[model samples]
Target chain A: MTAFDPARFTRLDQYGHGGRLGIRYHAKAEDWVELALPYAADQVGDPSTGVLASGPIVTLMDMATSMAVWTRRGVFAPHATLDLRVDYCRPATPGETVIGRGECYRLARAVAFVRGIAYHRDPADPIAHVAGTFMLMDAPAKQARA
Target chain B: MTPPPYAALLGIAIEAEGDGPPVLLLPFGEPVLGRPGFVHGGAIAGLLEMAAIAALDQALQAEGGGRIKPITVTVDYMRGGRERPTRGVGTVTRLGTRIANVEAVAWQDDRARPIAAARLNYLIERP
Candidate 1:
């Protein structure tokens, strides 16, 4: 069975919210995936400071975490976010691309546990921290689907 | 209060009235869809956060305005958001001198039954 390919999955994102938000794949590991959100004027949460909105950051983490589950399982399947929590350490610097990395730590029969962080330049200095769980819709299978 | 650009991106509109928290609306569209038949979880979270911010802003405006900075937010999704317009409203539970706690709920057809809910904490810098 072939492992889930985040690059291929993102390439088919023509009509999804992630595509509209300009999210792109950056890197991937066995249990984690990193995505990038370029700074845009339209995504400004505060017009005065040009700070990117928490919403878009949440979106970036959500997609990254979602993909992390697939990467961990070595297959793509249907799932839904059950709950998510985000803590903002600071605001993103204006005009810098926000990189989000999500890691799937535990995969159960019915749910997947994930945590993520969003940072501008260094992963050590994250702007936001995220923890969430996704409800797995399909049962585990031996063969991976491409 | 002027709606920010992110509001426009999510198709969020404020339905404000006489000196109270505004109701935020998110219409179903391609920009909000996640898995074809359902609205994205992030979009729903965004709506709830906007609602919480609106409520806090209204409360702060009544007491001589302040800058609101989000500290943390936790959202729980109870149901899958279908292809329809969703509504969200936030209520301030406690507004302290430095910190504020707010809760928001989002629903599609029935306000009594929420599809998602969120709890948010904010740091307020008084003006």
Candidate 2:
């Protein structure tokens, strides 16, 4: 089993309500994190249209990727996203919770690569896919203490 | 009628008015961040899309003109964006009867080192 840390996951209080994003940490995997995007944020636009706004999906993937890195490293490393590429496969239905699992595929001294997918019920039918790289920095000594 | 939802939400201001190509700007703000202190990639895409669409809007207006809608866009993020005002410059790649292509880049600090770059394809509604 992989080591897991609780501190890496963002709590409910940290998220905005309605579309409040939630993260669930798996005890068995240190580098794997699951993100839940509630219906409020995920189901914007029209239900019949089946067109979820790309904004919320992007936000979810971005947060998930960052969390995956944070979990593996065991601390919140100061980082900036160098690039994020998202491809929309299908629109996620409103009123459905979309789950995203992100993994840090590779990490260099200063750069980290991440990839993940968002799906509603079937992983085989993904709603969106994302690939991104983040530039990491050593935590400031002061922040590291707290 | 109100302006397009995206234009209003993004606060993009039209700088020059014409059919050749339109120019717009996205004011930098904290709300556009991915991390606590970094600009969000989605926000960058939004900015790039706006700039591309605005350029197409200008071209259509110039032709006296056509309706423009987005087909697809791809962005390559280069560097981290600083917490300062940035500008996006867009140029038309092709303006045909039914399709328009545009390229744009967002820069802060120096234009030579852009924070992000993108290419956009738009479907034009010809009159």
Candidate 3:
């Protein structure tokens, strides 16, 4: 049996970049997860417009997808990002909370496929679209929820 | 390279520059740490991105300057960023009136052995 709990990472007490950006667990379900990146003045990329940096958005998507992998397997297996692609649809509106929702579409013996979108205020018009893959670095016994 | 606020948040700083774009250095610390003794992939990508922007900006300056907007970025993580200072550099491959292509690489120890690298495409708006 694997010692994996979805709730453990849901309300993550993350440090480092995630902590610096104030990333919070927003929502989650089987094989999918959503994360929140709060708007902050320091997070602004364009000082003139107060818009967020794309790099932070990329960071958010990365974490969202990484967790989605664990959620998909129902176990927290060590994994590393193999590659990630981010397509900016448009700049995020200033002073709006960006929500990133990532879904694990496929899982192979050693890889996990993920896709996600980030939106502010309205989900209809996303700020960015992301596609990525992760490689499992460790073997973990997957535990199924009863 | 002058560090931006995002770069500050990631604890990245300008290491050196000579005729070309400046090299960025990310100190290994709590702010950049990921998965215990390993650097977060996101942090590595962030460093590469700042480097890319710095290169793009320098290239545009010589051409009377313009606004650079990101279109897309593809980052390939080759190896884990270890618990050590990481260095990154962005090289502009092509600069056009309306578009620019940039490549960036991050290495922990040897420059030849990269931990991660990124390719960025930007849309340019001339003033």
Candidate 4:
């Protein structure tokens, strides 16, 4: 089996799909990390109103929270988001970038807990907030694959 | 104390408030609703979070204003929201110095049946 490498999934290469999706790793801590989403296709809206869509925001929350857990485990653990909840405080501006800071609060045997806040420039006013749980799946055994 | 700037960006309006919980009102528009005519679950989640935050803010204010961060939020979809204006309400279950628990229900026309229900836990950070 190939060894687990966290560097294989850097924010720039993993999240950079092109045109719309753009993610950058701003900082990292012992068990936490901050990600910035400059823009994404899912976040576009009416050009006149400049309202950011919510789909990208949801996707961002899912990915960011998952990354937080991945960073703490220090290995690539295949997992799926069982459930996610996001609160929209307000619509994001069209030109402004949204930042998500996620932290893994607890890691159980099979489940991990994560929470984060999405803001643009002002923390007092968050664009969106999210919290959810992920079900950790152990990497497939090498022998099992063959 | 006023509504956060982000609230304005999302166009959230707090219609009413009471001692227990606060009511938040958001207009359903094409950009927000995921489907052509149906409201997206993500949008509903967003609304639930906003209501929960409002409730948390109120609880903290009463307790002398401190730092509060979200811990976990679980959303249950009960029904599909139509492409119209919807209302949301959040109530506090447990308010402590360290943690605050809240439950919120959102619906459009029928108050008895909720389109979505959510429970959230907030970790309080004292200032």
Show what share of the native A-B interface contacts model 4 retains: 0.11
Clashes of each: 0, 4, 0, 5
**In candidate 3, residue A69 scores what lDDT?**
80
The weakest ten consecutive residues by lDDT in model 3 chain A span: A137-146
Candidate DockQ values, in order, are: 0.83, 0.21, 0.74, 0.08
The residue-level lDDT of candidate 1 at A69 comes to 92
> Which residue pairs of candidate 2 clash?
B19-B58, B19-B59, B19-B61, B19-B62
Quick one: ranking by DockQ, best first? Answer: 1, 3, 2, 4
**Where is model 3 more than 4 Å wrong at Cα?**
A1-5, A139-146
TM agreement with the true structure for every prediction? 0.95, 0.68, 0.92, 0.53
Q: lDDT of all predictions, in order shown?
A: 0.89, 0.64, 0.84, 0.67
Assess candidate 3 and give its lDDT: 0.84
Candidate 1's DockQ: 0.83
**Candidate 1: residue B51 Cα off by (Å):** 0.8
Window of ten residues with lowest summed lDDT in model 4 chain A:
A11-20
Report the lDDT of model 1 for residue B20.
Answer: 68
lDDT of 4 by residue, B1-127 (tens): 3554434544668888667667888677644544246665555666777787778778788878876555556787666678777788888899887988988889998879888788887778788
Pick by TM-score: which candidate is best? 1
Q: How much is A134 displaced in model 2, in angstroms?
A: 1.7
lDDT of 2 at A91: 63
TM-score (C-alpha, index-matched) for candidate 2: 0.68
Give the per-residue lDDT digits (tens) of candidate 3, residues B1-127.
2456777777778899889998999899877777777987888988999999989989998889888788999999999998899999999999998999999999988999999999999999999
Worst 10 residues of 4 chain B by lDDT: B1-10
